[model samples]
Target chain A: MHRRRFVTLCGGSVAMLAAGLRGVRAEPFVDFPKVRLVDAAGAPLKAAALATNDAYVFHYPLRSFPCFLINLRKPAGEPREMTSEALAYTWPGAVGTQKNIVSYSAVCTHELSYPSKEGSEIRYAAEASPLSGKPGMIVCCAHDSIFDPAAGAPRLHGEARDPLLPVRLEYDPAEDAIYATGLAGTWLLDRFLKSYRRQLIAEYGAGVYKEPVGATSAAVLLNTYSGGAVSTC
Target chain B: MSECINRRDFLKMGGAAVVGGAAVTAGCASAGPAAVSAGFKAALPRAKGPRLVIVGGGTSGLTIAKHAKKEYPKFDIVLVEKRDMYSSCFSSNLWYAGLINLEFLADHSFLDAARNNHYIYFNATATGLDRAGRKLITSEGEIDYDFLVVAPGISYDYNRIGVKDEDTIDALRTGYPGGFISPTEHVTIRRKVQEFEGGLFLQYVPNGNYRCLPGPYERACMIASHIKKNKLKGKVLVLDANPEITIKKDGFHAAFKELYNGIVEYKPGSAITGVDLAKKTVKTEFDSYRFEDASIYPGVRASTLIEHLGLMDAKSPQKEALISQLKYNYIGDERVYVTGDSRPHPYSKSANTANTEGRYVAKVLAARAQGKDITWYSPRTVCYSMVNANPPEAISVDAGYVLNKEGTAVGGFSPDTKLFEKRDAAKGRGTLEWARGMYRAMFEG
Candidate 1:
């Protein structure tokens, strides 16, 4: 165990931190303002209330950046270091009482395919997917890249060479609420923004896509968010 | 008087003769006219690092030009492509059925791709290669390179279809184009599909490991869909040379039977023995069939550029380059290489294969440039075939190759290769996204 220090930057909208962990390398972390996850009806989402069968989608850090909040149904493994083309960081493991709650960027690390209102190429497969052939895996059918969210979202198969970017989460036992505090491998966020500038502008306003999701962000079921057009592969 | 003409003057005369008789002499020679240089280096900025010159800016060259820079930042890359505009050949079939439009295939720009990836996009046709001097001679000028990759893709072998004379070859080339190589052919095919009135519209499938094994079948389905939608009195006859549907057979067969039962007719073991252009009929060994319109896809060989550059393997039935199947370098020369459909590999000659293989070759170039080496890894081919355009359904295959028992070259599909032959709307959506992902990988940073 080592001391982790956070240095506030950009007027608390963003912070730089040095991740001090056993296996994880020291890297600059992009800490966004903590946003409480709420359901579609503006009610605070309880960590324990989340269904283990399917994942939930939430906009965090920014209005356009989608993240997946999943309950593994079983305790997640120990904190592990993950590497991507963007950066290297430690997924601090699940944070619920049972240590079964985890979240990762919905963007496919392979080519940045993310969930939209119409459809999503990447989805959480609760059962064994034809592509992954394993339960509880995130499969990106765009190129058949599979990730195990229970174990730091490491890539298990296909063309992707990096693990899925992890989203940092904090649990409130008193309120039974969950908060997204920061994101690992934030460099990919810049890439996703640049690569999808036109589509994001159409989805969100011209520049509203990059606006920080101030205090609370709405979370919705993946099926509901993508209108049931999630690819199971 | 002839003796007084110096080698330079004689070469200039030869170049003029080639230009004058372009159509007649296009594919007749193994190489293009001798490299008549502009007598200067290409108008490019001085290389800040080791220059990597890649010819044929299709999927393979474009991918390598972008990725090689990422793998080794010290290497400067310049892509030499003949076409100023980029229209992909992979997803062109979707255009015939109006599932997608011309913009979908042609909207991608080479200038934008080069600017986004920090590479030079030199619009020039590669005419010859000076391997020893490390110079790639192009129509514009010569480019000096520390590393060179030629991924010119495939060319149609008219002789394979028994069309030996230049006149009939030209007639077939212009009248019923293959729709596999050029954007012009795609445009022509799209127009023919749109204007088709009735009768048999033949789609020929060539023999051997032709480019896009399932392309003709997919196109047949698209054309049949068009015919079905319009209630036209016609059928698309898929004259496949192979004994059966080459890939994703079950899906394509199901589409033919279930979706376009009356509109699409598939005939296997129907290799085109000869084409009588005047009669609009193609002859197999046992039978001759007449067609109202046809995309006469003859047998394919490596791009004539391979033979022009003298990198072709004489023993290769497809006239592919003589390169290491694993490393993609010339047999004896590491400075020069070939990839994409030009390489003598048994891999699928599709955009996905080229893109993945390009990334691997980029790593290989980076390692060799640094005086180091990396182990061989297989390139994955994730291909999607649209079987129905009415509701947009597709089948897909996710395949990875493995070396043979001898570990010498790519032998067959890996154990984990999976085929989704059950056509569904999900895979159909995946089909479009898959192509979009490929575009993002090649064109975006």
Candidate 2:
């Protein structure tokens, strides 16, 4: 049984499992209002900014997570079933609209290069989508590293030993705002977060509000965003 | 971290630490910010271990000083810098595009970095080097050292671009400031952007290996992003000396076309031959373009300080001074080590590379002091470029270098680097992380 599937069967929600595992150990975890999906100009990341298979690069100052929002609202033929928590983290493009908006960290586990930023597009389901090719795929140009975002951004190609990091997002129904809740992946971002916080405090003071909640446990982060919700093995 | 830890307190602490006694004390000085502006006293207490003097308290110099002090505190370390504050050339483009504030760009108290590391911080500009005597002559006075590290950074050749005569040079310096490496230069460029009310704004990218490879392109993207977001009238004319985009070509070009659209006018092979200060215009071989405001970057060379020390080989280009591949030491003198942008080593002149080499050099020096040998490790660099604002995508190139048996460093991905546009925003964010991490490792870590 897959670790994610086993956990999904045991816990009703992956977020619950993550919450239990990371609440104590996480280094300042981000939640609603604290983390907002913002575009390049620091505006709220919206559904309209992206189309089917298209991605919008989203980031907040002080956090070095190379994250992208994709509209997986409508799959090729049969819609792949996913849990609400997984959908909320990454699904459609629009918040609350269930536009099948999804987001993932583009930082390659191998060398930290974001493939999407270099004009590389995401891969969709083919006539017969491979297990690795299902969901969504991102390819790196440097060493041809492939990641399946739909299947928790698992490594499908190249030298990347681990799957692509997933960025967990929360959706607001009324405001149509997408808030980044947490992340599940490599520990490359913690150092960047510290630097960002220091600068923010130094320049803007403590009053300015731009806090990102970072997950402390690598296992918790990986399990939370793995295999569309948790299921017992 | 101290009760009376001001600039004067730092200098006093440094001096006392150098002397090494039960009590650390010094004369009282005014607590004004300009206290260190005048400069620290030339007379510093001698150290027990070998003294290492680092010129130019930038990434390379600071990194070496900090690492040396941390690893072996007994070793004496002194860092010399001309400016009181350092404005980083690494990510100043973020400031130009309004992504980050100028405060984020400028480091008013890099002296604090030295102080925290227990290294002597001298706020005096270096005037000349006495290689034979192992002494550095600064504005304050002469300071002797057992080992000297020259990392003064690069300088521009204004004469090469037909900016002859002091008046023309001065005009271009003030009017069209090339905000490449200097913090003051960044301020000049920032002000120009803020005050841009319309008309043409020209930014000419120089040819050859300059400070940061993606700097000019990133600046153009930032400027263009500002123009489009602010809804400013007119366009940003990016005139490049190279025939095409030197690095991250696809990403930058896509950014220009998809993000800024008509707001950015890019012209390749349009190198700046001459600048008319009176008219605020620049001329290329094919055509002459006028600008209301501009930042004309001429070709860069090693700091004149390296040349003055007679470190450069006669066969080397008049621009950069050549250094050994395995050891960053100059071929003529091993005691006087040279690294960073000033070195003629076949590596990209970048902050990342400098930061890596600084620590590496410090280790090498430490081993040498103990009569030990360490393997020569090659340097690595990662450069991130933010192409667009709204979509907020960023691309990057990570270069891992290896020195061949022939004593030449080879990076398969040279000026022909890789890119990552799809998750560019992530890369953009990574840029901040990388810059912060590198800067921290250099000064604070």
Candidate 3:
């Protein structure tokens, strides 16, 4: 019930401001207008109705950025402190009646390979994958990076040095709906934008890719979103 | 006017020093009359901090240049490269099968990488090194540095193929260029694949710890794909000097049987003894074969720059740099380092290995600059081989190295190493992205 309060109480804003003053290319944390999570039909999605087998893709904070919404079949872990090259912050625990829902930035911290329409180098494996050899792990086949989403999405193996950026979520019990509020590890977002600027511009029109997602953002299953081009490894 | 001494002249003066031992003697020879008059300094903005100079613009140098600045912002880095343009030696076989274009390998700009990471990209060929004086001699002029990294990659040893004479070696180099080093060779090999009509197209695999073990086998598959696509009567003759395929053997063998069938012929343990250029015939220990066209890959050694700069290990069979395996610093010298394929480690000579190793070496430089030290770690080698071109199926290997029992040098592959020898379309798709990710890591901030 008080999961979101932990982020502020941990002095995250102060740490972020300090990081900003260090002249790092990007801010450690970024806040965006709360966007209701809607299904393809533009209806707010119920948190309990979300699938427990695979991740759902949603554009959050920016039009080109992709995030993964997952239902951990079980209650998520407690809030914990995590550090990356960009900044240090507390990852708020999962939210919902059972506290079994979570989300993270799908872009890999290694080289920013994200789930695209053509195919996704990163995917959620409900069953054991050859690379991760464990279920409920996010695997990036491009360079064999694995992350455990249930445990704050810490890096489990391979070349990635940092965890997946956390996408803060809010669950309204009255409406049984979920919303995306803020993002941590914004430094990677800054890089993903600069590194793939040309392709993003070609896809979303010049400057449109960087525009903030409006009041509501659509969330779709990774399988449907990538057209079944997900890599198992 | 500044007196100029090129690499050729320096090599000529140090020819006897190589055999006589002690690189210090070679330095002594170059320090005579010319060293006093060599007053030119490379036109560069003065170093704002501890000047770090990196020689070579390949995967190793580029990654270190960018990451070193990130690890230690106080480091003012300079990357000195010979070529004005950038083209990757990795993933070059894909060009032969039309899976990728030249732009994919060459479109990354050195100038852009330097600008994005806050460093300087100086286009110059390193001619020599004055370790005591902390000066890097280049074609343009000299550069003073607090630290230096030399990563000049590899060179072909034609003598391993029994072609010791300069004339025959020249003939083989031009007539059957190995598509492993320069961009010109890649271009020539691609043209040969496109123009192949109907005969034996030879792809030779050299012995020893050569660069890109899967390269020759991968090229054979690409050429065989071309031959099969055009329904040409020619076959790709893979002349492997080893007893079996060096790496990812099952995947390549499967492709040879399932995909290429009659188009690819594999010959193992066929070390080339000589090449008769006039007759287009190659002689191995037990057999001689004729070919319509060929890419004669000879054994590899550290780049000739290593020996020319007097950094080569006198006892190293491959003429690699004489540096400490853990720190990559020259023995008894902390100011200088050697990395990349020129390293004596048995790790796969691959882009991925160098990229990861360069990042570690950058950390080493950053720590040493601060008068600190860190423990050593191994580099990872992630390599992919395209086995089929029509639908694009591939296999890959992810490996990490381990230290020896004495905790000294790289021993062999780590236990966590895994091989995806089962070729599939998913891996084929992964192969392309793997290269793109590598390019991004080396070229972007």
Best by DockQ, which number? 1
lDDT of 3 at B349: 83
User: Which portions of model 3 miss their true places by more than 4 Å?
Assistant: A1-29, B1-37
Encode model 3's per-residue lDDT on A118-140: one tens digit a residue: 88889889888888777889999
Interface RMSD for each of the candidates = 14.6, 17.4, 12.5
TM-score of chain B, per candidate? 0.92, 0.86, 0.92
Over all chains combined, what TM-score does candidate 1 have? Answer: 0.91
Q: In candidate 2, which residue ranges exceed 4 Å CA deviation?
A: A1-233, B1-41, B408-418
Interface RMSD of 1: 14.6
* lDDT (tens digit, per residue) of candidate 1 on A1-233: 01112212322222221111112234545677789999999999998789888899999888889999998968999998766654577779999899999999999989889999989999999998888877999999999999999999999998887788888999999999999998874656766877898889988889788777768999899999999888867
Q: What is model 2's interface RMSD? A: 17.4
The global C-alpha lDDT for each of the candidates, from Candidate 1 onward, is: 0.83, 0.60, 0.84
Model 2, A77-102: lDDT tens digits are 22222222112222222234654666
What is model 2's native contact fraction?
A: 0.00
Name model 1 segments beyond 4 Å from true.
A1-28, B1-38
For model 2 chain B, where is the 10-residue window of minimal lDDT? B21-30
